[model samples]
Every structure is written in C-alpha cells, then in structure tokens.
Target: MSASTHWLATASIQSVLERGGNAFDAAVAGAFVLHVVEPHLNGPGGDMTGIFATADRPGEPVVLMGQGPAPAAATTEHYRAEGLELVPGAGALASAVPGAVDAWLLLLRDHGTWPLADVLAYAVGYARQGHQILPRVRDTIATVAELFTDHWPSSAAHWMPDGEVPGDDALLRNEPYAAVLDQLVGAAEGTAGGPDPTGTAAGRRTAGIEAARDLWARLVGREAEAFLARPHRHSSGTDHAGVLSAADVEGFRACYEPSATVSFRGHTIAKTGPWGQGPALLLTLAILEGFDDEYLDPSTELGAHTILEAQKLAIADRESYFGDTDVPLGHLLSTEYSAERRRLITESASHEFRPGTVPGHPPFIPPLRVDYTPPAAATGAKTGFAGIGEPTVQPDGETRGDTCHLDVVDRWGNMVSATPSGGWLQSSPLVPALGFCLGTRLQMTWLEDGAPSTLTPGKRPRTTLTPTLVLKDGQAVSALGSPGGDQQDQWQLLYLLRTIVGGYSPQQAIDAPALHTTSIPGSFWPRTWTPGGAVVEDRLGQEVIAGLEARGHVVTRAGDWALGRLSAVVRDPATGQLAAAANPRGVQGYAAGR
Candidate 1:
C-alpha cells in the first residue's frame, strides 16, 4: 500500500510495488516523481528526512538523515558583514548542501531491489513527457512572476516562457532535468564496467549506485556553485552572492541513524533526533501522556485546548534548544521533566513563550517579534513579495510554497515515511544547468549568537521536515507524515491521538478536522510568533471553536479543509492485513493498494 500528497507519486509507488519492488524502492520512485510533478513543493535541490523499518529488522526504526549542514563559509560573521540580521528566506545564501538526492540514492543502494535506472525511469518519463501543472504550482509561478522576470531571468525562462505564466493544467516538461537523469544513469552504467564480469550482480548494483551518487555530487555541486556565486535578489530585498561552494556539496553524505523514540499509549513512536523538529513531537507526546484519555480527544473543546497548550510548551523548547549542537534530550524526555511541564498547562491559553527550565542548562530565549513590517528598502515596492517564506500556514491560516509527503508499506512489513521539501521554484534563482534551485534550509538558523539554532558553519539548521514510524509488539505497524512547516508534527499529533487514543481508523483519523497552535516562534524567516493564536479547520465544529476562543485562544478559521496534508500506510503483522489513507483536503492526495 502507498499514500502520497500527489496522485502521480502515489501512482508511481503503486507501479513500482506491483513490479516486485519493496517499500524502499517504491518510496524512492515516488519521491523522484514528486520532484517532477510537484516542483513548487519539492525538487532535486531539496532536502528530505525519512524513518523506516526494514522487513528484516522490523523492531528497529532507522532515520534517513538527509538534512545537509551549513557550508564551511556560511559563518554568522560573514552574513552579519553583509548587513543582514536574518537569513533570507529565498536565496542561495540560505542553501545548505543538497541532500535529498544523495539520501534517496543511499537508500536505494543499501536496501532497494531495483536498479537505479529502473527507479529513475518514472521521474524521467514525467519530466520529459510532461505532466499537468497543478493549480498551486501555476499560482506560485504567478506570485513570483515579477521576481523571475526582473531579477532571476533563468527562472523566468524556465517557469514563464516568453514572459507568460502557464495556465493551470498546462502540460509542462523539464527536458534539462530529464537529461540530467539520463547522464547519471549512463555514467553509472559506464563506470560499473558492464555489470561486473567477475563480481556478483549485487556487487555490480552497489557499484552502479555509488557511481551515480558521486556523479550527482560532482555535477550538481559544480553547477550550483557557479550559478549562485553571481549576485542575485534575496528575500531580504538585497543583492548578495551565495556562500555555498563545490566543497560544501561534495563533503556531505546522507546516512542512517537510530530513531529517537518515546512510548505513548503502548506504541513506540519513532522520529529523527534534535537536528530536526522530530523530537518536539516526542516531547509533546510525553507531556500529553500524563493526561486522561478524554483530554486527548481532538473533537471536543477541552481536548482541543489541552492539545494546543501542550504543543505550545513543546514547541517553545524546540525554539530554544533544538539544533545541531549538544541538546539535553535525556532530561527533556524524562518522566520528571514531563511531569513538571505538564503541571504548567492551565485551563486557559498561554500567551507567553514559556520553555521549561532544565538543570544546568539555560534556555536560549529567542527574540519574540509579534508583528513584522518590512523596510521600504527591503520591500522594493514589491507588494506580494514581502514576508514571503516557506509554504507554511500564516497567522491568518493562508498557505503558499508547501512541502510534499509520501508513505509506503509493503506486504513484507517493510515501511517508510518520508517528507521531502525545500527547493521550491521560488526558493532561489534557477540553476540553469540543473533546471532546479538550491533549497533555503539555512533560514531555519538564527543570525544571533549563542542560540542552539544559531547559524554556525558546518552545523545543520534545525529543520522541520519530520516523518514518523510506529512500532508495536516489536514489529513495525505504520509509517506516516505530513508537510506543514512547524505545524507538521502538530497536524500529525491529531492523527496519532485519533488513532491511538480515540480508536479511529487511519482514514477516519485523517478525515477529521485538524488544528495547530502558532503561538510559538516560527522556524522560518522573519521569525515571529502569534501570542495565544490557534488555526483550526471550520469542520472542527463551531462549539469546539467557540470553546477554544472562550478559553482565550485567538482562533483563526481556515475554512473546512485547510490545515493538514497528511498520509499514512499501515500493516497488521498478526493478520498480514494492510491499509492506506491519504488526506482529502486538497483533492490531490490519494492512497492506492489492492
């Protein structure tokens, strides 16, 4: 079974699985297709993080550490010298080493059954033979049309041929990206020496995969370095050259690591470490575990209030402590610390940014700017471009430039949940040679010194691309994830509560209305917070919404289906039954299986 944010990706996964590929292979195929079909949401120049449990090791959850660190020259001093206070949200200067391709390739080399050529054929076909452009993709192009035409002409040439934005559902093709894939495949085959005359087939496959990885690093990195080194317009409304070099890209490699886990409702929930925001979900679950089942319900007013409060507390800690530095995760996840944090959740909403005190560790309090107005110089008289950041939910619940998610569970108990994001067409100027842009992941880092998430050379910015894996009875049971920035885990929290605590099935849980608190500091650029703010879908009911508002939550109604874009695939080890569910909100996501 497979579920993904886009129908094409889900269809690709179905085809791969039907062709004797395992969950890993299906996921890789679907992910590459996403880069082609959902270019506004993700691309080859992006980053991704996944958690999976192999069929041979069902009990152990492994995190695919695909997030890249800052470049060696990405120093806070250099950025400050450029007369910048914050990392620009959409430029090469905000790029980390591109890691999504390397990570997916690593997974394919280590665990997949299909060859690289077969896996990439799905994406190559879509990129060369064209796919229907999504309305959102077209809309995003229109929004940034001026930016492309005036400053990033390469982007204008790619997205808007002859200075015209393509209409929705227009057939779009990326021949450059398709050619890039062909080159990778040809290079890999040539370097592998025609299937290795003396070595085994497995040996040849590994060799080919490694050759592809090396070629990607060499080709993409060199082109990106040359393109971004030229001065370009940034979200800050400044023209600055990027700092990422070929060495930065060549030095990074994606690898697997043990997942950070916390037991909740007799289920082991797995996530990436503190380098990403995955641990914040675990911390929220730990805090909520002390509450009664009734309070965990997401349908009622009381349950909504409790969940929002818990998320705020957990996200506060995330803002203060989560990064690529040493974090006191042991104490944060301890029962005593959870109890202490739980005691602070009052009946009413909290308008304050409160991170609990940890022993011998002082919380680094970030600047809390409630309202942000760009300077006239920064705005450049550009109306729509001001305050643009990741495609995340705004304070008023509006969204743009969102992420993509996919989940696959095969009959063999192999399961994977992956969230691929960044490198939106609007992220940076198009790297003309690669037909893609570098991601702005470095915007998650602070320019301020001493913060755990501060922009430091060679250290990863705390990312929000989180995926989840659930295990029960020493066997992997489900893999799930979504694509909201800071709200990623918040939306998934509702799904987890509905399924694990409310006894709702996967589809039932996904169909339910969703809500997330925005009271905490945002991880994106123009970092700000909304005090006592919460955004909820109107389908959650007026009574519940009014109850939250009465409890002092500054609520924003996001229509009936505007909050989450989640999907999941589940397996029952005892019965060998499999199921999949995808969000119906956007009318795009789908689940496929037989």
Candidate 2:
C-alpha cells in the first residue's frame, strides 16, 4: 500500500483534501483511517497528537497537545497506598479524558475546511466497514494480546477480528464498530443531536450550511462510562473518574492552544507538543555543539562510541532535571543546556555506570531504566554510561506495543510532526469496550508511592515520543519522527545529523541502518535494549558490528527484518522538491510524495 494511503503524510492529507477535507479535516480523517489500518497502535479508545500549520497563520504555528493527562480519579497515593509494586493495571485509573475528541474539535474549529461530520464520515465508515489486517497488525495483536490476557473480552475481541487473528493478510472488519461511528459522527449538526459541539469557541460550532446545520450540530453525544466498564466498543463516555455520577463530554478540556517551544541549533521545537520533547532536543543539540561533528561521525568504532557516550550523558541528565517547566522540579536542577551541563557530560562520558531502575528490583534492573520519563539528571554526576538499554514495555514476554509517527508539509512551506502512543493499561488490563484499546501508559512511571510521575490525579506521564524538525530562515527543511519508544530520539539524531546536516537525501538517510544507546538510567520504567549500531538484514554487514563492539558497544541485533520503522519528509531548498522516505525495516513504513 502507498504511504499516502494513510493520512499523516501530506500526500495522503492532500488526497483527503482532493476528496474534500482540509488539513485539519484530513488529519482527523487520516487518524481515523490509521485506526482502521493500524488499530494495534491507536484507535478511538486511544488519543491523538497533531501539528497543523495553516496558510492563514503563516507566522504563528498551531500545535495541539492531544495526548491525555491522568484521570481525575487517579492519585499517587492510590498506587503507593495499594502496596502494588511496579506499574498499575488497566483499570479505571489508567485512562484520561479522551483527548482526541477535544483536539479534533479544536482542529475542526480552526483549520477545518469541511464540516466535522464530513471529516469523520470516512473514519466512522472505515470503523464500521473494517480494514484488512496486515502482517504488522497481526504481529502486534499476536504479541500484545497476552498483556491484555487478564482483561477478558478486550483481549479476545481485539485479536480475533477475523476468527483467531488471521495469518499475514487477513480481511478484517469492524461492522459493529462501523454502526457505532455512523451514529457518533453522523449526529445532527445542531438542534436535533444531543451533543453541544459548542461553547468552546464560536468556530467549533461547525455551523454547517443553514438547512443541515442545526441537525448535525446536535447529532451525537458522549456520556461518561464507568471507569472499569466491561470494555469500550466505541467512543462512549467515562463515568466521573472515581465511580458514579457520570461526566458529560463537555467536562473534558476541549480548548486547544499553542505548545511551549525551545530552539536547538536555530530550529524551533515543542516539548509535550504535537508529540513530547521539545526541550530534550534542544538539550541534546546544545551538548553536540561542544563536540566536533565530523570527528563524532568517524569509524563505526569512534563514531558510535562518541554518540553512545554523549547519548548516555545527556539522557541521564534529562531523567533527573526534566519536568514540566511550569511545575518546576525544585529538587532536580534545570533542564536548560548550559556550560555546566556540557562540562558534566564531558567528564561523565570517560567512565561507565548503570543507573538503577525503580524499587531497585530483584534482578536489580541494572539501571537499564526506560527513557520515557520527564527530563532528568544523573545523581551528582558520577559518570553514568552503559552498553545496554532496551526501552522495552513488558519485555521478555513477547509482548508488542503500538505507536504511530507521521510528518506533514504543505506546499506553503509549513511542516508538522506528531507521534501518538499509549502503553498497556496503567499496570493491568481493563477494557471498557471493544472499539477502543485503552492505554496503560501510567505504568511508565516509577510509582514510588509519593513520586510525581506516579498515579497523580489528572497528570500526564512523561514520554520519549520525540518529534524532530529542521527549519532554516524560519521555514521548515524537514520533519522527521519514529515510533521506537526511547530509541526514537537516538535513531532520529543520527538520521538528522546525516540526512539534514550531512546532506544525504531523504531516501538515503532513511535507508541507512539505525542505532540506539540506552546507556542512561531511566527515571521510571525499565530499559530493555542496549545501544550501539544496528544493521538492517546485515546491510552494512559484520565488519561494522565488530568495529562497534571493539569500541565498547554491545551491538544488539534487530533481526525483525523490519526494525524501528522511521518515516521522514525533506524539502530541498533550491528545487523545492518534496521528498519522503520510509525506513526499509517496516513493510508499511513507505513514503509517498506528489
């Protein structure tokens, strides 16, 4: 299938527009389509993060932080108080107010060229009609189904789309779901439907043409469901976080605003933005400036060695020092890049150390902690570096996690990058319906009883879902992103350095094998894979690995044929040619351009 077949790529977005959807509409449409195509990663049950720059807002870009924050009923004390070690389960506590709807409404309000009902028409249709399950989808279902094993119907339902998870190419359909979408997205625009898609702003009213406007406006509505209901089959409702009196759709924070931005090497970025990590990128860039780029890109031994060292040092500092800049982790130092941080990084890289994971562990986690936490700092800077890191989710279990990354650029010199993710349930499985797969992202936190990232009411867990963009003269040159958990930034940095800076074409950079270094201590979750250099199908061969190993690299094998699928788009300055490439590791990770 063509990459444009999905919506995030501008080719596909433009296709939707040709079929009568605007950028906002196309994004929403693409997301819905993606749910049909790659339900294992995201769906109506999950959330969305979108960055759409309208020609109208040429100067100020629009960013929608669509990902959900912790639910109101969740409390840090609740998890710690339960004596539950590690992450929580996927019960009522794991979910957040469905942010996709709110973000969708916000985007519809601003840049939507068509009616929300119209944009959702395709998604709802696909949900009901069903899409075929590709190898990737089946792989995800087969691997991840076990994590949801305890959740009953959800586990059984999600995997058995076409009689016991079809092998390879299986025809899949969500008829029951399609009916539901028809009802939800088909709600009247105004007077007739129960929902008041209004009050947020005048624009969201979606005031369709006079005749059908009132009808469509009031078409559909959402009533909160029980926190731990059977399982959601569609975008239903969430009863008040704790228990009874149901909360209405209106209670969700539906307003959209610009994201907090940081600049790195002259490029603007957003932390917790269209995807998380605007500051981290800036911090990494700052650290890189202190070194020689050409020297850093030497032998598989010297090159990967330098990056590994730098990756460990910078990532370690982020774990301790990073937090919501507004919330201020007074105990931790500032995440801003500084000469002190650079100096500390240089000093710390000369030695080796493994940061400890949460609870210190029985196997003792070996400091191979996950990297999705807020910005952090290594303890007192005692030289933290290791040859290992996985950034795994329920590792050694053969479990699979779902995630999506897509970048879009309009002909108008505007670009957008967004990554959407949710882990297994909080710590357990709790599916309310069949239509949506609830995210257990809360489990990503350390859950150390009183720790901040733990089960805090209405708080968003930290994530390493970073999106990378390059802008020159305030115009976008390229937008790049991946879905490899913590390794995302690591692989992305390499890609950016070689492709954007070293001047490799988009396709060439994408074809290049990727590497990762988990050499830093995770703030919360356990780190799984080690970092060094990864060869695609032995593409660059053993010589590279041997050289890397000699440099103290673990050189783990990513044998999955397709590993860490990366998608990127590049804009050539002189030619104005728009080129895109999908990493070879992923069958579906192909890029299309017009």
Candidate 3:
C-alpha cells in the first residue's frame, strides 16, 4: 500500500483520517467542510441521518441519530390557521436548530480521535484559500443556480463570482464564509468570546437564542451577534418568508432518542422512535422479504429496470403513509405493516396492472390509508422483527437540511465512509452575513392539504439523506452514501443490491447508472393507490426493459445515469485489498488510492 490509503471525498474528511482520525471523526470534518465547499449540497440549515459500522470501533454498527426536533414552534393547527397555501417559510419556521454541529460534537465525543480544532482546520483552510471552481461543483451550481439566486444573497455572491453565476473554471471565492467558519470554530472551542470564550459575561451574549444558551458558542466571538440578526427565507419555487432573528439561532438544538425504528436486509432490523425513517426502511424491507427471489425474479426482469418497479412500490408507500410514529395516524391493516398483510399485498401485486380494472384486485386504499387505524389484520409477512426497546425518549416531528459524504480504506485494513450535511446551501437563502444556507427541506410535502410530510409547526420534512455502511460477517466491508435529497437512501439501496446480489465489485456498483420509481399507485393487484409511479429507461439491457413493458411500467428514460451521483470504498477482508470509485456522470467527483 502507498504511505496512505484514501478514496474520493471532500477535502476536510480525508484530512482528518489522513492525520489518524478514524472514519467517524473524518466524516464529521468532511461534512463541515462540505458546508463551505459545496454549500449548495449542504450546510447547517437541514436535518441529518446516518449509520455506520467499524471494525476498529466497538458495538454493532451504530446509527448516529440526527433528525432535528419537530418545530416546537410549528403547530399542527398552525398550517391550518395560516392562510399560507402550504408550510410557511417564515424565518422562524424556515430554520431548525442545526443538528450537524451537534451530531459532529456527539460523534467526536464518542468515536472521534481528533480535537475540534483539528477537524475545523480542513474547512477553515478551504474556505480561506478558495479553490478554483471545478466542473462538478460548477455544474451542481448550474443545476440550481436559479433556486439559490431566488433567495439567499450569499448564494448569488458565491455562485455568481463575476456578477453572473460563473461556469466551470472561474476562480470561486467566499472570504465572508471563511471568516464565519473561523468564528464558528472559535465559538465551538470557546476562545474568541472577548477573552471569556465560555460566555461568563466576557461575551456579548446579546443576540441569538441558541448561541446565548451555550457558553461554548461564545467562540463565535465578535461575529455571533451579526450572525443571528439575519433570518432564513424559504427557497421553494413559490411561497416563502424571511424573518430570521438572533434568538432563533441561540435557541437551536439537535434532538435524539435511544430507540426509534431501524431495519436491515428487508426487515425492520432493530430500532425505535424520534429518529425518522429507520423503522420505515425496515417496514418496506419486511414487506419485500415475503417474496422469494424466484418470485421476485420471475415476477420482474433481472436488469436495474426490474428492481426499479419493486422499489417504486415501496417508496410510494413511504411517500404518503410514512410519518413520525407520533402522528397518531392509525395502522394500515391492524398494527400497521403486519406480515400477514404484506403477503396478501404481495400476492396481489403480481396481478396488479393486468390491464382491465378487475373487481377481485386488492383495493387501492391500503397504501394510501393516511388514518390507518388497526382494523387491518396483523401477520408475519409484514410484522417485522419486534423493534429493540428504545433507550431514550426524543422529540416528535423531524428536521430537513443537506450534507456531504466521503469514505476510504487503507492497506492496513482500516476503512471509512463519512456523509455530513443538514442543509442545502445552494438551494436555500443564506443568512446575509453568516455565510451558510438555512435548509428548506420542508418544501418536500407540497400537497394542497393534509399531506403527512407537509410542513406543520415543528414537523420535519421527508428526507432523502441517509448515510450508509455495508458489512460482511460483523466486519466493515464498505462505506457509501451521497448528499441527494430523498435520493440518498434509494441510491444507497440500489448500489448495495448491485454490489452484493449482482456480483459486481464496489467500484462497478458505484459506477453504474441508476433509476427510481415515483411515489404513485399501481394498476394491478391490491391496486395500490401509490403516491407516484416508477419509470425505467428503455435501456440498461434490452431484457430488463422488455420485462417492465410486459409488466406494464410507465417508462421514462433519463440521462444515461439518472438517479443520483454515488461514491464508495470497499475492502475484501481476506485479501485486504481496497477498491474506490465515484460516479462520473452529472453529479460528479473523482476517487483515489487504487
């Protein structure tokens, strides 16, 4: 092996690991740096979610819980009361207490090997020096340049270095953000607060609710007051507010619980509530487990197209019915997500889309039932492995934001992957002088009325951000994930299936183009009134496309590689070899340590 072993990722995370910090620490640093380097992809404005397993560390791979609190401020009736067409983006509502920093602190407190200063340095240097805008970064800006320009002044300044959004090759710079990073680092460390960084009257403590509450936050020093004055405006295509304040920033806090739901291999693995989607992932898997590959394979094609349809069915359920377990929405078929119910649904799924509207088909209501009271029977096919008892109680509702990720493995058998972001920097409005985006993830639920994910006071928007790790025999096998909204979990799933079940190496898996199903209903059995539809390109092997057409999939071909960009690192335990790969398509980046 070369003197060091690393793979594709933002600079900060790699630097941490290179200096001896493990994946966890490196991941934290990488995420922070991403806030500055790829501001559009993530920052402190959104929520965070991730899971990891380490051979160098102890315990069954732990899930780093980071879904921020349901806004104590956005009440259920608030949405109804506000004549606002949908969830309001008022400054107070647009921002959630940022969890990325808190999550970073918790990770370091538990698994990190580096000090806060050490990790912050990577982001600091990148911000201060400013790198030339690479094609990938520039292209990403172009994708949502209009969105950023629509809201945050900082975004326009960053993306439009030349008064207009600069294309690739322009020397990009954000000195103001770098200055903010310096102060945030100082604040976290308690140094810049006018000689009493820990806020013992030595600091201003005059602005920002969250900042004043925590003595350590004084490290933000002189800039803290200025930082809080600006508010976050909504960045959705339409309908937004921008009244942010100092108290709001000071009041921000990250929430966590011991036992929310979690899952693995198509079953709710072991988890409980407060954290979002962990159980839902398992629920989808549980329902899928009932069908043997024989049934699944013959039922669908072998190409990416085949899996696309099945995945669409699962995601559709998630889009409409899934919500914070606290929602009080009744179960779909008795105790919601029961095994017997799943088998029945599966049996009918094959007959779905058989052309004519058949009377015997399972009704279209199960998947769409928002108020799933327990009248639905409970059975094994769907009842997942009983969830592990939760260890802590957390807040209800959820958070929205963006993040960044990177993973690496070395010759000595050390491997790591890190994803960090809780806000979409480029897509949301920047707090004028603070230099970061207040994520607008709440816009995900835009239905006219009563959508589960629709914005409510304190409720978190549905997310596509799930960082993941793959293991074999209780040892770390590989690490992978991305910053795509809502696309995060699906991308990881598609890549994992490609790597393990398809016999492809991790590189092959990361390199492959991907597809996704819509949040819609199905035409065949059980007649799922899905939230969306699934579209497979007419390519990716003729056989796969033919099968979908036969089964009646409404296909829409995307770019050669459409779903999202993917990056990963894999190591075979026995051989001690490392493989790293990155998606070279539109969502771009490169890899190393081959």
Local distance difference test scores for all models: 0.91, 0.49, 0.47
Worst 10 residues of 3 by lDDT: 385-394
Best by lDDT: 1
Q: Which regions in candidate 1 have their CA more than 4 angstroms from the true location?
A: 194-198, 375-387, 395-399
lDDT of 3 by residue, 333-446 (tens): 223444543534421114232111212322223234212211112321221111011100102211222346666555455554545554554434455555665544443433
**Which scores greater on TM-score, model 1 or model 3?**
1
Candidate 2 residue runs with Cα over 4 Å from true position: 1-14, 89-92, 144-151, 161-163, 191-224, 227-250, 254-275, 296-299, 325-337, 344-397, 423-434, 449-452, 521-544, 560-562, 572-576
Q: What is the lDDT of residue 154 in candidate 2?
A: 51
Tens digits of per-residue lDDT for model 1 on 257-347? 9899999999999999999999999999999999999999999999999999999999999988889989999999999999999999999
TM-score for all models, in order of appearance: 0.98, 0.77, 0.71
Query: Between which residue pairs do clashes occur in model 1?
Result: 391-400, 391-401
Q: Model 3's lDDT to the true fold?
A: 0.47
Provide the clash count, candidate 1.
2
- Considering TM-score, where higher is better, how would the candidates rank from best to worst? 1, 2, 3
Over 513-543, each residue of candidate 2 has an lDDT whose tens digit, in order, gives 5666645544323333344323323444577
Best by TM-score: 1
